[model samples]
Target: MANFSTNEFKAGLKIMLDGEPCNILENEYVKPGKGQAFNRVKIRKLISGKVLEKTFKSGDTFEGADVLDTTLAYLYNDGEFWHFMNNETFEQIAADAKAVGENVKWLVENDDCTITLWNGNPISVTPPNFVELEITETDPGLKGDTAGTGGKPATLTTGAVVRVPLFVQIGEVIKVDTRTGDYVSRVQK
Candidate 1:
């Protein structure tokens, strides 16, 4: 396995620590007035979603994680696990709730998703940044209430609730930013 020196530490860099995979969330180089420079890093355990702060000396090193991210299409879920398929190979994998995490709310049928595999098994799944989903449920829009920024909670077809403008009605497709869980815009279709 290859090793990464402190100089290589940066956000989104995956490495192995304590025999587990962790992604570097943040890394800052701090040089003291009289001592060696060290890297202050914030890391998140990939499997557990645990965030940890650690410091490593300038010469410190860690092995690169055996993690692979692949784009897959979302299949249906069976309550216990979510299924995804690699279109290139037609291979499929089922990710449990832990791996899917909060991304479940953004999943739409046949949408492309990024799934990380560790040791040939799924460890994480990420939906697209933007998704257009039809509103399945929401309160009726007011006749002439388009003045303020006030909005109502709309439940999307994927079951994700987002605050949308009062003009948005049920069955209308709207764009949503999955990264922030915010409503982007209304889609004509």
Candidate 2:
């Protein structure tokens, strides 16, 4: 356990409050020009996914949670457990699908991801910000539609659909923005 002042709050920094794990989502140092400096923090509960706003004086200290992050390679799912192996140690840990949530969509075999460990147990998995996937299905691009002003829906090999430009064609590889699930641009083959 460690102590952090309110001014040190940052996103993804886990802190304990009322015997529960909470992470700082966003923190802003505010001073009303007449009052003492304070930190306005938007915190999210790790287990319940609840978000709350709290204020603390700049000099206040809080108990920070002991969280460990390790790079893990994603392995295949065994119907119940999603397995991952630490790249450095080759140690395996299996987490349930519910624990992985929508992040499972971005999991490609052998892909490396950061696993957040709380009390030596996997609590969350964060995938890469971007991934390249081949377009499996999409209508043929309109002939002579070089305007590139509109987009059409296309399905990727992962079964995730995204809007690609009208120039995109089936069997073409494209870069996908995992954060927004939107097509960035078609990859040059």
Candidate 3:
């Protein structure tokens, strides 16, 4: 168990607090003209996804959390839990909806995903920033109409619906940004 001082607090730092692992989302130092300095930290709980703010003295220390992220191949979803497999060891890991969060819409079979493990258990799952998905359903595109100033809604193969350019067709594969659920570009070939 390593200790982290207030000066070491930064975004993406994981530390143990109140017997749970929490990720530091934001850390800001505040010094008053008359009083002592403190660090304001915004942290999100690992397991439950709850977020809170805590203040620590300038010299306060916190234990480092045993958090690690590993790349895993996504297998499939069982309606209740999403399953992922480690390619090297053939070990499978299951994560519930909470852990998957909005990333579930970006998962396709065989896609590589980053799984955050805390104390040997998966605490979060992050899909690739960009995903290529084939459009399963969408309105037909008009002839000689290639501009996408006015896009149409499209349902992807993964059951996630997103707006695509008017030139996009149901059979065409397009790249989508998972973070914002926006269409990036059409996949060539």
Candidate 4:
């Protein structure tokens, strides 16, 4: 564990409070003209998903959790558990669905992802920021809809639906931004 002053607080930083794990959701450095400076932070409990607000003096120090990240390849799911293999050692680790959560939609077999480990256990899984997938189904472009202002809903191979320009047709590959689940552009291939 490392000590960090309140001034070092930032979003996504894991810290230990009262012997429990919490993640910083938001942090603001607040000071009223002549008053003492402090950090107002909104934190969420990692295990319980509960959120709470706390304030700390600028000079106060808190114990930062020792979180580590490692690149891992996502393997096939085993019904209840999502399995991943460490890129370096090829060791497999299984984590509950909740740990992977919505990221499961962006995961493709053998895809590489960053897995955050807390105390050697999988805490969170982050998928690639962008992915290329083929459009499985969508309405054919309408006649004389040359302006291309309107878009049609298309389903990807992974079963996630996204709106793509009318020109997009079935079996066409397109790039998607997983962060927002939006279409980036059509893939040439």
Give the candidate number with the greatest TM-score. 1
Identify the runs in model 3 with alpha carbons over 4 angstroms from their true place. Answer: 48-52
lDDT (Cα, 0-100) at 25 in candidate 4: 93
lDDT, each prediction: 0.92, 0.83, 0.90, 0.84
User: To one decimal, what is the Cα RMSD in angstroms of model 3 from the true structure?
Assistant: 2.0
**TM-score: the better of candidates 3 and 4:** 3
What residue runs in model 4 are displaced by over 4 Å at the alpha carbon? 10-12, 18-20, 23-27, 32-36, 42-53, 143-147
How far residue 80's Cα lies from its native spot in candidate 2, in Å, is: 1.8
lDDT of 3 by residue, 69-128 (tens): 999999999999999999999999998888898778899889999999987888799899
User: What is the clash count of model 4?
Assistant: 0
Model 4 per-residue lDDT tens digits across residues 1-189: 888878778888889888767889999889999999988899987655689999988789889987777888989888999899977898998878877877787887788888877788877788888888888889988745543586889988888899888877899999889999988897886
List the candidates' TM-scores in order.
Answer: 0.90, 0.80, 0.88, 0.80
Ranking by lDDT: 1, 3, 4, 2
> What lDDT tens digits, residue by residue, belong to model 1 across residues 1-189?
699998898788899998889999999889989988988999999998899999989879999998988999999999899999988899999999989999999998899999999988999999999999999999998857773677999999878999999988999999999999999998996
Q: Report the poorest 10 consecutive residues by lDDT, candidate 2.
A: 142-151
Clash count, predicted structure 2 = 0
Q: Write the per-residue lDDT of candidate 2 for residues 46-116, one digit (tens) a residue.
A: 65668999988888999998777788888888989889998788899998765687777777778888787
Candidate 2 deviant stretches above 4 angstroms:
7-12, 29-38, 47-51, 57-60
